[model samples]
Target: MLKKDIHPEYGPCQVACACGNRFETRSTLKEIKVAVCSSCHPFYTGKRGAVVIEAGRVEKFQRKYAGTRFGKPAQETEEKEQG
Candidate 1:
């Protein structure tokens, strides 16, 4: 026999995502919030533009190493040649 009042309550719950997608489901909590969902997820929706970038990280990295040579930096290259 199953114990009564031992398990947490399960009822209808609302899920909201960062992309403004909302759905209803059953859960212990009354409301749920998530950063990603099927509607906005890149893998699920198969959209390349869905990717989110912050603070121009790719641009910053390119700028920082724009003058550097390939593979190793100048200091490492010099050290390798000496040893």
Candidate 2:
């Protein structure tokens, strides 16, 4: 068993989810703010890609890196072009 006074205060943690799901769990912190939770999570709720569609995070990333080549260094590309 852990000796008393050696550990940080462990008490109920109030979690506030973006989807209006509030639950209490044991943690060192008193409160936590989260963007997703089991109630509204895509995996738990069986919502495939719904969050991505609504948030546009995936689409925005794809658009930002669509033209970028992967696994090829910029210097290697320049050397190939020069030779």
Candidate 3:
């Protein structure tokens, strides 16, 4: 037995995936956003590589510390080498 009024409302919901896949299903939430879904999942799609979105932080870090002892900057080492 279940209470009639205690349960949250469940109805048709729209699910959006980052890969531009959208589908309708019943859920407690009216809308759902997901990073990956069955339509674009690697296992389902048979893709071997994972999707990665970089925001330049890795490039910035490497540029900021290219070659040094524990990352002291590349210019100082270059100057030391030349001197």
Give the number of the best model, judged by TM-score.
Answer: 2
- Residue 11, candidate 1: C-alpha displacement in angstroms: 0.5
- lDDT of each prediction vs. the true structure? 0.80, 0.80, 0.80
lDDT of 2 by residue, 1-83 (tens): 99988899989999998878899999999999888888888889897765532577666777777656544579877877799
- Cα-based lDDT at residue 25, candidate 1: 98
Q: What pairs collide in candidate 2?
A: none
Ranking by TM-score: 2, 1, 3
- Which sections of candidate 1 miss by over 4 Å? 51-83
TM-score of each: 0.61, 0.66, 0.59
Candidate 1's displacement at residue 65, Å, is 12
Tens-digit lDDT string for candidate 1 (1-83): 87998999999999998888999999999999887889987889888667543435777787787656654578986876799
> How well does candidate 1 match the true structure in TM-score terms?
0.61
Name the regions of candidate 3 deviating beyond 4 angstroms: 50-83
Worst 10 residues of 2 by lDDT: 49-58
